[model samples]
Target: MEKTTKHPKQSFTVMNELVLPNDTNTLNNLMGGRLLHWMDIAAAISAQKHSNRIVVTASVDNVSFKQAIKLGDVITIEALVTRAFNTSMEVRLDVWAENIPSGTRHKSNEAFYTFVALDENGKTVPIPEIVPETAEEQELYDGALRRRQLRLVLGGKMQAKDANELRAIFYKD
Candidate 1:
């Protein structure tokens, strides 16, 4: 069967959660693990939307918690599939925290997650190609290759010298 092409906007996903007491640490800020869990789920949904198949998280890039989310604050997570390659796709997620009482909102952090689509039999499956519409989406689409190469090198799956895109940036000849 021929695979279809999907626009990045078509796979956009937004998730919101309330920072409850149980979700906070002793300092009353939302625990980093809890936030990571939320991000994983949101990114998975976006990947699934793009693939239309069972998606499993392949890897998560580093995530830095720059802002603290206090109890009762609303945490919003937005995810979009930036690029699709064969069976794997890269999802970008942006996190924001909002204080209802004070009517303030600020960026918490951003992260990249890689997901692979699977068939019902549990084997890897090819996903639809990503069609970036906006300029920002196009830019992200272009950068996804370099990011994936970096991750592969860092994970030891690929040698640093084999990362052509990344090598070009630092090792110009």
Candidate 2:
């Protein structure tokens, strides 16, 4: 099979926010729910950019918090379209937190979100094809593919009714 070339679509702005006291728990760290909310927003933006229509989150996968964001930090959430299947697009989001004092930025969280393009009736709609232009774009596209497969495996395991079936799916090569 010929290697699939990467389609690097235009980057989309999902959403962003400044970390504040109210957005944090007692520990002054950003709340998980808040981060998830931003991630979803970012994913929706990417889906819209690809489809030029409204989109809805079908599912979110593998949200990992690698670091903590403290108060007085600016968080930037960006999403890029990495893959598409029919009406669904997989968006990879990276959340970076910049400390106000030090002006240093760190990747605090990352997640993969699946969105389905929607028409005026809120039904699934097709999205434009993505074309990756550079080596880095190809790498990002490959990463998204890996993440998509992982999502499918995890989702199968989560939805399996039988524990044995779940185990088999999880352990499959």
Candidate 3:
């Protein structure tokens, strides 16, 4: 799963504001929904750079909130396109939160998101082929391939009813 890259071809940036009292539920912590929204935005930016077209979230792989982000902590999201398929790209995002007063930073979350390039009519469109320029980039590409395989397996095992339900959640008109 590793390919060598001399340099990175594409990159995208996403900024997240700190959690506020209003942004939190009664737990005094950031809500999962809010974090997901930020991740979606960051993934879209990365996917658009790889495709050079409008992109929509096809699915989100496993997302784990490893640490809690508190109020006054700035969350910075960095996303890179690790792999590309015929009409889809896999973006890996690193979510880090920085405390303003102390300048301390910590990784709060990470996730892989699948995005498909879209045409004006909302059909799938082709995306550029990703060529790894560095060893790290190649490793990321390879890891994405493995993840895609896992996703396929999971997709295949879904019961008809559950598959339909998942489709409904993702493809609502």
The per-candidate count of clashes, in order, stands at 0, 7, 6
lDDT to native, each model: 0.90, 0.75, 0.78
Worst 10 residues of 2 by lDDT: 1-10
Q: Report the Cα lDDT for residue 61, model 1.
A: 95
TM per candidate: 0.93, 0.79, 0.82
In model 2, pairs of residues that clash are 6-132, 7-130, 7-131, 7-132, 8-131, 8-132, 14-42
Which model scores highest in lDDT? 1
lDDT of 2 by residue, 85-157 (tens): 6788888788899997897999988877888888898888887767777787687675665565566667784
- Which 10-residue window of candidate 1 scores lowest in summed lDDT? 1-10
lDDT of 3 by residue, 1-173 (tens): 11212224655556566667877767677788998988888788778866779999888998988988887678788778888989988988888989889989999899999999999999998878888888998988877766766676587854444444345545876
As for lDDT, the candidate ahead, 1 or 2, is 1
Q: RMSD to the native, candidate 1?
A: 4.4
Clashing pairs in 1: none
RMSD of each: 4.4, 6.9, 8.8
